[model samples]
Structure formats: structure tokens, C-alpha cells
Target: MTSIPWLTILVFLPLVGALLCLLSWHSAALCRWLALATSWGVFTLTAGLFAAFRQGGAGWLLYEDHAWIAPLGIRYTLGLDGISLLLVLLTGFLMVVAVLVSWRVTRFSAAYFALLLGMEAGILGVFLALDLVLFYLFWELMLIPMLFLIGIWGHAGRAPAAVKFFLFTLAGSLLMLIAIIGLHLVHVEAGGAPSFALEALRGTALPARVEPWLYAAFLLAFALKVPLLPLHTWLPDAHTEAPTAGSVILAGLLLKTGVYGLLRFGLPLFPNAAAASLPWLAVPALVGIFYAAWIAYVQTDAKRLVAYASVAHMGFVVLGLAAWNQTALEGSILQLLSHGITTAALFALVGMIDERAHTRRLDELGGLWGRVPRLGFFFLLFCLAALGLPGLNNFVGEIMILIGAFQTRPWWGAAAFVGVVFAAAYMLRLVQAVLWGPPRRRDFWPDLDVREGVVLVALALAALWIGLYPAPLLQPLQAPVADLLGQVPLGPGPGGVP
Candidate 1:
């Protein structure tokens, strides 16, 4: 074992910080700084971990496993591959941003920051947990803080939206729990050690006939979280209602969990079933792409427009996953990263707009560029990134998805291409409405302050870095993605090589 189990430390540090925050309930300033420093500390450590992670390999390094609950064959297992590292970094980075963004939050400030940090910890666990039961615990743990954030600090209708979000996720989680137990039993029948470890379960060769049910259980759980198409009704409301930091994390980390689930478990464990469900799955994926974009074009509320765009962006993720090719899978993963950064920034910017103008109605606002050049610049930059303009991060992800999807099924890719066009339409429309037109009500249109500028600048820099030099970010995941594709059984690679 390495001298330090950095990954475990990264996972639990915030939780420890959260406990400390609770102990200092009366010291709001201390709570805020504590959360920020704790998050920054995690980010700093992960930066070191990324530097240490081996490139182009499939085995766990710095892995720490310990026996716990021996009767049930459970253990505390933690490891990080390329894919997990990026999300962990993203999680840490966004937590720092969340703290910075919430600097002005005065109501229940200590409790709010604690919950937010707690949520960040849970998300970190989701990305890093290597055991199935451990994964589920982190998965459900994510819902509570978010629900409270939305219900308590969220917008007017947040209470109802939070309830809907909770119920939907809980319902799907129940179905997934059964599926997980089923897989556990299957592993037992295969003579494998009783364990919830992902790597352990991957070795179990499931029977062909039962694969679909297992896939369904996993898919439904993730799909609800991703909120694929019909299941996505909860997202717009949640995003629209949650506070800025809540929305940022929702867009940045929570939504990615679904796509992460597909990549991490759905495709790998149930390859044949995943391949079988493509045409049907592709339908919603394609539908969501254009469907969400078109509706976004018509949305009068800026927040809702961004909410719908997330559906559209996630659709590309689904399409890429279904394509099951290297290009598509890589692209899908890239899309996940790109959308996380871009959407988080957009929500933060929108929150600033709403805070200043007391409204987010697109038609009612205009010409803020004159009042706030830096803010306007960020809004335009993020919009271009969101719309997949060349040279931005999303362009790389979306193009890769389209190319990969086209290689598998040209028509599906073609349909997705139209969604790309629709994305541009709405994004450009939003930019023009918010940043180009004459100030509809520019009186005292407050611009980005030092803190606000810090947040948006960080987001933009990430977008630029990922857009321009993605190889560094993408290389770590090559082993994991390749390992995942190798499981597909017929995806142009030898089995077990990924």
C-alpha cells in the first residue's frame, strides 16, 4: 500500500469537514472557509493523484481494500482509473466553485455550506467507489443534500420540484437495488467470492437470457438519474428551482452520474443486452437531442432554456454510448465532461443575471453587454461552447459522438446531427437575447464582481483547456474505455484487452 491512501482521503475528507462544520454551527464564516479549504485541499491532492496515475493500463494502483462486515462478504474497496480521476477532479474543482459562488448566501449559511460540501463528498464517493453496494450507498447519499438544497434554499416552487426529484430517484433506486442483489446472487452461483466489488463482478459471465433484466434494472436506475426523455421531467424543474450552487452541482456532477453509470456498469456488465437495446434506446437519445433543443428555442425563461439544453447535451452521451464504438464511447465520455463544465458555468451566470435583474425572462432582458462587459463575454463564450462552436470543448465531444455514431449507424448519427443544428439555433438565440440587444432594463445592471469573475473565469479556463488539449485528459481514460469496449464482445477489439 502507498504511504497514503490518497483516494480514500479524498473521499472522506469532506465528510470530516462536514462534521467539523456542524460542530461550529454558530460560526458561519468559519464554516464557509472550512468548506472552501477542505474542497481546495481535495482538489490539490487529486491534482497529485492524476500526476501519479499510470497511463494506458487497466489494473488498479494505489488500491486499498479492507474486510468489513465479513459475514456478508463486504469490504471497503477504493481505486481510481483514468475515467474516475477526471470526474473526481471535476467534483473537487466544482466544490471550490460552489463555495466561492455561495459567498453571499446568508440564510442558513452554515447548514447550507455543510450540505453542499456533504453533497460534494457523496459525489466524489460515487465516482471513486469500486464496490457495488458501496456505489449504491454513495448513489443514494447524493439525493438528500440536493433535495434539502432545492427544498429549502431553492426557488418558489422548489418544494414540489424537490419532492418530485426525490420520489423519482427513490423509485428507480428500489428497482436497481433488486437488480444489484440479483447480480450478487449470480456472482455467487458462478463460484466467485461474495463481494460487491465492480472488478469482482466483472469476472462473472452471466447467462445470455437473463442479461436483459439485469441491464434493465441498471438502466432504469441510471436512466432516471440521467432522467432519459420521459423520466427527465424532474430535471427542468429541479434545475430551474435550485439555488446557483445547487444548480451548478446538479448540472456539473449529478447529471453526469447517469452517463457515468452507463459507461461504468451498463455497457461493461451487460454488453450483449446493451447492444441489443440500441435502436430503441437510440430513439429517446435522438428524440431528446432535438426535442430538448427545439423546446429550448421556445423557452422564455433563461434558466428553463439551459435546463432543456442539458437534456439535449445528455442525449449525445446516450447516443455515443449506444454506438459502442471507440470513437463514440470516447466522445460520450468527453461530452459528459464538457457539458458538466459548460452547464455549471451557464447556471452560475444565469443566477447572477436573476440576482441583478430580479428576472430571467429572456424577452424582458437585453443589452447587458454594455453594463457588464466581462459578464457578457462569459455568457457569450459559454453559449458558444454550449452550442458546440468550433474551438470550444463541446465541439470536440459532440463531433466525436457524431463521428462515432455515424460509423455505427449513419442514420442515427444523421438524426443527431440535426440536434446539433438545433443546439446552435437556441444557443445563439440566447446569446443574442441576453448579451447583444439593447439594455431592456439596463438601469443598475450589476456586472460580475471579483468573486463572480473568479467563478466564470475558472469555468472558461477549464473549457479552453479541455477544448484545446484534451489528450492529457483523454489519455488516462483510454485504458478504462478500452477495457469497457473490450467487454462488448464484438466492438472491433479482442475480448479482455480493454
Candidate 2:
């Protein structure tokens, strides 16, 4: 709709910056500054786009299309709607934090920073690309950088962890590719051009049996990324081994890709089947909440604890998605944002602690309050938020989810309520071990430096801002979500999405 090609710039600028960082690999400091500047520049553009966005229509806020592989009807298409805007903003913001957190890395630091920038580009591409092929390209782009980050920069078992992660994700993606090809062929069979553009492929009627199978393929692909329940084995290992920046990107942006894929392509393209799949979906999601909580509470390693907690948190988001109403969907989207912030903050803090004290084992960490009260305080704040403390970001999302789930199925709502209680228990257990339980070390650790303080405070402020006043975030989601849910047979909420 706009001639400026803003979405292209937003998606690829970091990629260009990555190249620049590699070229300047002679100095890590130069690369660091470049990554910081590039990430923030993207964030500034994201903020500007938000300010410029108008909400009168249910279509893309801005769209761009260009010829690419024209003979096959494939095109370079990118679009920005409210849903994309939020996720892209999240990617840009966390990327800045990732660079800052990794400021101390000296081993191939320039390469490290380059990979981080490349990660941002890949993630932004996934959120923006309107062509399924382009989307998959970006999706795989995310994998290579992440694999290197975990295997090269991570800890003792990084090798195996990286392998597990790569294998699981690739297997799921291959299945989804088959599904994408299936959809494209279906479109062609229906007298449409051979297009992989989401816009064209959408609504090409599937045979009753084929629809469910294709939908299941997309579901598994996204779920593996969401890493839901039993499929989530790679995350704890990946989180435990990855460097701090890698962990932040993993929790902050990488995990969201699955949920975003569902919202963007899976649900809308196969609405009735998606809605119908909820009953089966709910079982694993509900079970995963308790399973994650139980495993998280018993963990000795702090990072792995947060890793399992991520599974539980995402389970809530999955449940909200299964509910399929506007309230539940909105809550799912908000929780996606909230979980990204709180979990990334926690991992950052945990990484900082490991840097200081040489251990992430819960038994070895206590009395942090007496040594580093500033760090202790921020840790406590984010932990409470993770546990759904009232007036905190996660709570608002959790409450709305319960209400929405209750309206659709009271048992679902009640089950979620119990899950929240479980969340509080394990989350507080972590707080007790790290912040208030007992001193694992009497040696003093330095308090937050200016840079560290800046990162935590920024995360804290975002949590509080959204927790206390979520209207800004909620307002943009209204039409986009309405439009998304409108595709299903239950009812239409607003205009079309693709």
C-alpha cells in the first residue's frame, strides 16, 4: 500500500548490518557498537511504524510485492498488520538487550555479534514475509545461527544440545514444508495460478481428509517450535547450553515463532479444522503445565528451571489459543509478549549470576539479597511476574485467559486456575533459593553496573507498564485478532486477514 518499501527495510536492514559487522571483525568493540546501533535502529523504525499505524481497517497496515520466480507464481511479498508489528518490535528490543548482555564475550566476539544481528533479520523475516516459501527461508535461516550459537559459545554439553535442537526443529519443518506444498498444489488444482503467496493459497478448498492432515502438519511444526509438552525436550538443554545472548533470543523471539506461525498461517488457512482440533490440543497443554511445574521445581540448575517454566508458561498460551474466542486469543497474544519479556529477563539475570559466582545450581545460590540487593530485587520482580502476580504483565494475560476459557468451557477455566497455583509454587521456590532462602556463598558480588541496570530496568519497566496499563498493547490487537478469528465457522469478528 505504501511506496516506501518500509517493511523490506525493517526485515533486511539487520541482515545488511550483519554483513557490515563481519567486515569489521577486526575489532569486537566495533562489532558490539554496530550490533547495538543496528538493533536499536530497527526498534526505532518499529516504534515509528506503530505511531504511524491507523486502525480503521482489518487489512495490512502496509504491504509490498515484487517479482521473484515469476514463472511459478512465487513473489517477494511482505505485509505488516498489528500482529506482526508487536512481534517485530519485540524482536528488535530483545536483540538490543542480547547484544548488551553479550558485551563481555571476547572469543570471536565479532562473529558472535554478527550471528546475533543475523538472528534478528531471520526472525523479522518470519514475522513479515507473506510468501510461504520466503517465510520458510527465514525460518531455516534462524536455525543455522542458533545452532552455531549453542554449539560454539555455549557450555559443556552444547554439542549434544545443539544437535537435539536442530534435529527436532528440522523434522517438524520438513513436515510443514510438505503441508505447504500440499496447499500450493491444492490451489493449482482449483484453477488458481501456481502461487505460494499466502494470499492466493488461502481458502483453496481441501478434501475433508486432506485438510485435517495438512492442518496437523502445520500444528506439529509450530508445536515443536513452541516445543509443547513431550516435544519440548530440546529447549532445556538448548537453554542450558546457549550463551546469554543466545538464550535471550531463544526465549524472546525464537519461541514466539511457533505461536506466530499458528496465528498467521495455521489457524486462518484451516479455520474449521483448527477450531475442531482444540479438544485434542487441550489435553497435552493442560498436562504440560503440571509436568513443567513439577520438573522445574525439582531442578538443581537455575537456567534449566527457567527452561521448564517456559514450557509451563507456553502451555498457558497454547490453552488460550485452543479456546479460540477473542478474549482467549487476545490473552494468548499478550501472554506471548509477557512471557518473552519476563523469561528473557530471568535468563539474563541468571546468566549474570553465573558470570559472577560460577554456578547456576540452586543449592549453590542463596542470600543474593545480602550481596547484590539490586540484582536480587529485579530478580524477585520478574519472578513474581512469571508466577502471575496481580498487577503484573503475566497476570493480566492469565486472568483474561481464565475468563475466556470459562466462557467456552468451565472445566477448562478451572483446570487453568489450578495451573496458575502450580506456577506460583515453583516460581516462588526459585525466588527462595536465589533471593531470600539462604546464603550459598558469603563472598560479595558486585551490584548491577550501569549497563546491566539499564537492561533490567528497561525489562522491568516494560513488564510494569504492560501490567498496569495494557490498553496500548490491547488496543492494536483488537482488530487484528477479530479479523483472525473471523475466518472460522463459529462466527466472523471483523474483516479478512490475508
Candidate 3:
């Protein structure tokens, strides 16, 4: 372990704050301030971890372990390599911003902050936990707070969306739980002590007969969370109804957990299954790429439109992962981070619009760019990045994914290329209508306030930083990426393989 107990401190500090806030429930201001302090503290710790991380190693660093349920081989374990470290930081960064954004939600305010802090703790634990059971505990823990966020604090029809979201997630996770137990049994049967540590389980080779089913269960759980294709119907409603902070976290962090699980567990633990399912996986990803972009083009609601674009962007992520090469996996991770930052910004922008104008309908929006040029500009920047414009974060990841896709099959790249064009169409349409078209109400349009500007600027800076110099992000991930790839037997080189 590293000299600093970085992972534990970063993960649990928010939970501590959550408990403290609950203890001091009568003082809303105190609770809000404490929540913000805790979130900022986590972010600062993540910054410290970033500054201290060692790059280009064969395995993760700062690993910690202790027996939790020794009889069943479960342990309390946590660690981070570069990939997870970035996400942990992203979570920490957004939690603070979410607090800032929600500063004025005074109705049930203390409870709200407490739930928010608790949610952040669960999400951070999900990213940092190395034990399977530990990961699932965090995974399920997020559900309660988010349900409250959407149901208690959301808009009209919030209950339905919240219930739908809960049921879908619960069902998927249950299936995944079954798979986890099965994997543990396989490990035990292999003459290895039963263990749920990701590293320990990786050593057990799943039989070919059961690999596909187990892979399907695992992928289904993750894909449903990613809300891929057919499973994605709940997202638009959830986003449309969720509170601004909830929407931001959902788009930014919650969705990524699915893709993260796919990368961290799915491919590496069941490499042969992943390879076998590659053809099927690649098809939906490619189809979703174009379909989501087209749907986004037609959405009248700005938030729903952004929601659809997330589906489209995640298609690129799925394509990269299914491609199963170093470049593609790296690109997928980069895309995940880029999508998190940009999409969260977009949602936050929409939230600001709704807060001011009381609606998110595109037709009801117009000529704000002149009134809110600063806000419009930042929105445009994120929009361009979302569309994968060159010299932006999404572009880098998309290009890398495409390069990796092409290496696997030329047609996959070709399909993704078409999706890119559709993205341009919808995004430009959004930019034109909302920012530059005829004024909906010249008298009422107002520019961003100081707090809104702070949120947008912070997200924009992150997007630009990653867009310009991905090397820092990629370097630490190299070892883990290679470590993951080594588990899969990807046959011979391009020209040499049978």
C-alpha cells in the first residue's frame, strides 16, 4: 500500500459527512455546508492521489485488503489504477458541483444534502472497491438515494420514472448477483479458495459451456445500466424528471458505472465469452450509434435530446470495448470520461434553462446566445465536443475508437463514421435553434448567474484539458489496459493470425 490511505479516505469521508448531516438535521445550513465541505474534501484527496499516482505499472497501486467474511472468502478490498482513479476524481469533482448547483433547494434541504452525500459515497465506493461483494454493495446502495432524488425532488410524472428506473436496475442487479455467486463457485471448484476479489476471481477459468450464459447475464446487467438500445427506454423519462443535480450525476457518473463494469469485469474475467459475443455486441453498438444520433436530431426537448446523444456516444464506447484491443479499450475509457464531463455540463445547462425559463422544450427556447453569450458559448463548446469535433475531448476518444474498430473490421468504422455525421446534424440543429434562431422572448431571456458560470467553466476547462493532452490520462491506464488485455487470448497479430 502507498504511504497515504488515499482510497479509504476518499471513499468513506462522504459517508461520514452523510452521517454527520443526519445527526444535525435541524440546521439545514450546517448540513449543506458540511456536505459541501465533505465533497470538496474528497475532491482534494483525489487531486492528491492524482499527484501521487505511479504510472505504467503491470497492476494497480494503493491496494488494501482485509478479511470481511472469511468463511465465504469475501474481503473488504479497494484500490485504484489510472482508469478507476480518473473516475473517482470525476465523482468527487461532480459531487462538489452538485452541491453548488443544489444550494437553493431549501425544501427538505438537509435530507436532500444528506442523500446526495450518501449517494456520492456509494458511487465512489463502486469505483474504488476491488471485492465483488463490496462492489455490489456500493452498486445497490446508490439506488435508494437516487430514487428519492427523482421521486421526491423531480418533476411531474416523477414517480413513474423513478419506479421504472428502480425496477429495471434492481432486476438487472439481481441477475448479476446470481452470476457473481456462480463465478465464486467456479473459483472454489477450481481448487482455489472461494473469493470475490476481482484479482482472485480472474485466475479461475470459466468453462466454455457456461461462459456465454454468464457473460450474457453480466453484460445484460451492465448494458441495462448503460441502458443500451432496447433497455434504454427508461433514460429519457428519468432525465426529464430528475432534479438538475440528479440528472447531472446520472449522466456523468451513474451511466459510466455500467461501462466501467463491462471493462473491469466482463471482458477480462470472461475473455472467451466476450470474444464469442463480439459479433453480436458489435452489431447493437453500431446500430445504436446511428439510431441514437437520429433520435437526438428529432427530439423537441433539449434534455431528452442530450440524453439520446449520450446513448449514441456510449455506442462508440461499446464498439471500442467489443473490439478488444489496447487502443480501443483505452479509447473507450477516454470516451467514458469525456462523455461524463460534457454530458453533465449539458444537463446542468438545461437545468439552468429550466430554472429560469420553466421549460426545456427546444421550440420554446430561442435567441439566448445573444442574452447569455457566455452560457451559450460554453454550451456550444460541449455540444461540439459531444459531436466529436476535432480538437475536443470526444473527438480524441472517437478517433481512437474508430482506429481500433477499423483494425478489427473496416465496416465497424464505416458504420461509426455514419453515426458521426448524424451527430453533427442533430447537434448543429440544437445549437442553431436554441442559441441563434428567432427570439422566443427578448424581454425575459437572461444570462447565466455567477454560480452557473462557475459550473459551466469548470466542466469546460476539464473538457479542454483532456481534449488537448490525453497523454497524462492514457499513461497511467496503459498498465491496467495491458493487464486486462493479457487475460484474453486474442489470437495472432493482424497479418499473422489464422
Candidate 4:
């Protein structure tokens, strides 16, 4: 029973489901139902994993390792720690949301569902893979399906958006590949058996001069995906052009991978370099927080506004990571989960609105509160959460991040506080315009049906759970985050406080 390979099954189950989806190519109904069932099964299995999980465990749990690509010393390794565990769970939950939101897709439905399942598999593998090479394989696997999702099924500007996304991601990926190969070469030269396994390579001393360059390569790759600052141009375009399911997955899951990469690989692999580069990273994060918030405040398109809001929210995650403290890291992780749920819900609502009104223009939408009371309530709930209102999910994460940042540097905290204010301004404006502004049309708009209500209610409950008591999530993260911090060269206990 101990040899059941649960992690392997979790990672591959969606890919198997995708194959099954292809078999029902002519039957869109079967394809949709099968995809929904498979995703829900995965979510249920993840819950089981959670129930059986040993809290406060020191290292990876449900560990499995196998030899692969012997010449390069890569292994088919998978495992979960507190950090990856939450992310894998988020991935599973969001896959269900993504599939449900796409329930109405009628054109090329089979291929669409299959691609969704395929992307879910890749995202799961990314969260679970412990081998660097295997991680890269999963990382690349996530791109293709998303590319097609945007290009084939997205809005009017899908083609250009898809191309832009592919190019930016490809450029970053190439740099990351170079860094991975460089690390392997360095290991071989150090008279060690070449290995791309994380445990094997972690803290492996590299030449001081070469280390910074390698860190930069990885940082650039991840920052681009985090789409940090100037590197974030592709995100708005991608979000605006993608279909509802694509946007939900992009905002909820794919973006988190970049932050995950930073925590998992960037800092731990090159602590000294990471410490040296903190200000460089933190400044752009701070700037992006304000920059994106201001841009979001002025957007005409509803989805585009939400897209920019993602940039601002993710900036907080970056800032927390740069702070390099346990509280900050834990807050960043919570932000990851909270942002995934809240933002995905927002996107789903926007999709519903677009479906009804056939327009995302803010000026064109108003006074919907009277027509779609259920949707209005959920929209306001998620909006409040997004703006960091007290007792909501985003508030908890943001407060912790600021507290942690202030401990590291008061000025960083102060600057980020301004971002919080701007967040409230922009989000409130959105709520006011979409729900209470003058009605652009008098036609009756339908409230959420049972399926949509179920989705929103589930997300609302998750948000409330985190806001009221984050300890369940925070407790599991403490041990792993503390362990990760131990590897870094900064902070009070590391011989010198930064």
C-alpha cells in the first residue's frame, strides 16, 4: 500500500483523462462530462491527500523517485512539501472551475476540453516534479495547450495575443534552459555525479563569479512569467484575448508557477546571489504595484482591468518573497492561494457578464444589481476581497506581507501601503461602475444558474475560511518556509540581518 505511487497518479490522471476525451471526439456532451468528472475526481483525490498529509513534516511527503535519462543524471522524481502541497491542491480545484466555466463551449468542444485537461496535467507536474529536467519538461508542456486555447478559442485579438505570449515565454524558457544545463555542467566539473535532482543540487557550491549569472538567467525567466514590471506587458493582452476558462487558469494557476519557481529554485539554489539582488527585485515589485494599480483604475475593458489588477496583486507576492522572512513567505503563499480563488472568481463573473451583455466595456454596463442580484452579490464579495477589505481573504495575506516587509524595511512597507490604497480605489471604482452606475440597457439579465452559483458559493466559502482562520493553511507552510529560509544567507539568524 505504501508503494501505491499516489503522486504519480495525481500527476498523470489528467493526461489519461485527456486521452479519453479524444475518444469521444464526435460527442461534445460526453467530452464535457468526462472532463468535468476527471477534474472533480482529481480534486477529490487531492482532498484525500490533504486528509492523510502529516502536518509540520520537515521534508517532502508522498515521495517517489525513479531513474531516467541516466547519461544526464535526470530522474523521474516527484514529491510534495507544504508549499507544493497547497499549490497542487489549488491546481486541482481550479481545473474543476475552469472546466465548469467552459460548459457552454460548442465549437471544437472535444479538442478544447482535451487541451484544458492537458494543461492541468502540465501544471500538476510542475508543482510536483523534484527533478530540474523533469520540472522543465512539465513547464514547457503547460505552454502548448494555453497557446492553442488563446489562439483558437479566444476573442477578436486572439491571434496576436497568442503570438506575443508564445514569444515572451519562449525567450524566458530558453534562458532557464541555459541555466539548468550550466548547473549540470558545474556539478560535473566539481567532481560530482551529474544530477538535476533538487535535493542533490540544492546548496551545491558554485564558483562565486558564475553564480550571479546563473541566478540572473533563472530570475529573468521567472520574473517574465511573474511578468514583473516591464516584463508584464504580455499578461494584459493574454488575459483580454483568452476565453473565460483560459483567463481563469492563467490568473489562478499559471502565474503562480513563476512565484513558485522563485521560492523553489531561485533563492535556494543561489542564496548569496539572491541576497545581493534583493533591492533590484524589490524596487521593480514596488513600482509595479503602483503602476499596475493606476493603469487598472483607468481601463475601459472589464477583463483588461482585472488583468492589470493581477499584476498589482502578484507584485505583493514578489515583494514578500524579496523580504526573505518566514512571515513574508507564508503571506506570499497565502496570497497565491487567495488571489487564485478571488481573481478566478472575478474572471468567471466577468465572463458571465460578457456572455449576457456581449460587452466588457465599463461605460456600457451599469445598474445590474437590480437585474442579477446573485451575480452582483458575488461580484461585490470578490471585489471586496480583492481590495483587501477587513475579514476577507486578500486582507489577511496583504497585511501579513506589509508587516513582514516593514520588519525587513519600513520604506518598502510604506510604499506597498500606498499600493493597497490604490487597490481599494480601483476595485471600488469597478464595483460601482458595473453594479450601481446608470443602466446602459433595460433588458433583463439572468442571475447565476445552479452550476454558476455552485462555483461562486464554493469560492466565497474558501475565501471566508482563509480570512477567518488562516492557521490551517499557514501552519502547514511554516515548517517548509522556515526550512527554505535556512538555506538563504540573509535575515537575522544568518550571521547578518539584511
- Candidate with top TM-score is 4
C-alpha lDDT score of every prediction, in listed order: 0.85, 0.89, 0.86, 0.91
Tens-place lDDT per residue, model 3, 1-498, is: 377676887778988998888887888888889988999998998877777783546677678888899999899999888888888878989888899889788888878988998899889888888898999999988767999999999999899999999999888889889999999988888899879988889878778898888888999999998878888988888998999899989989999999888878887788888767765788888888888888899999999999899898888998988777888889999898899998988998888878777888989888878778888888788889988878888998999898887887777877788889999999998898788877786566678888788888888888888899888888888888887778775654342111
Give the per-residue lDDT of model 4 (tens digit) for 1-498. 247999889988999899999999999999999999999999998877876773747887778998898988999999888888898888999999999999999899989999999999999999998899999999998978999999999999999999999999899899999999999889788888889998888758899999999999999999999879999999999999999999999999999999998889988888899888875779899999999999999999999999999999999999998887988889999999999999999999999999999999999999988889999999999999999988889999999899888888877888899999999999999999999967889877888999999999989998998899888788779889989888885855221223
For candidate 1, write residues 283-343 as lDDT tens digits: 8898888889889999999999999999999999998887778888888888888999999
The best candidate by lDDT is 4
Off by over 4 Å in 1: 54-56, 491-498
- Please report the TM-score between candidate 2 and the true structure: 0.97
Taking all chains together, each candidate's TM-score versus the true structure is 0.96, 0.97, 0.96, 0.98
Candidate 3 deviant stretches above 4 angstroms: 492-498
- How do all the candidates rank in terms of lDDT, highest first? 4, 2, 3, 1
Q: After superposition, how far is residue 65 of candidate 4 from its true place, in Å?
A: 0.5
lDDT of 2 at 385: 97
Report the poorest 10 consecutive residues by lDDT, candidate 1: 489-498
Whose lDDT is higher: candidate 3's or candidate 4's? Answer: 4
* Candidate 3 clashing pairs, residues 3+ apart or interchain: none
TM-score (C-alpha) between model 3 and the true structure:
0.96
Residue-wise lDDT of candidate 2 within 212-301, one digit each (tens)?
999999999999999788899999999999999898999988999999998899988887788788756778889999999999999999
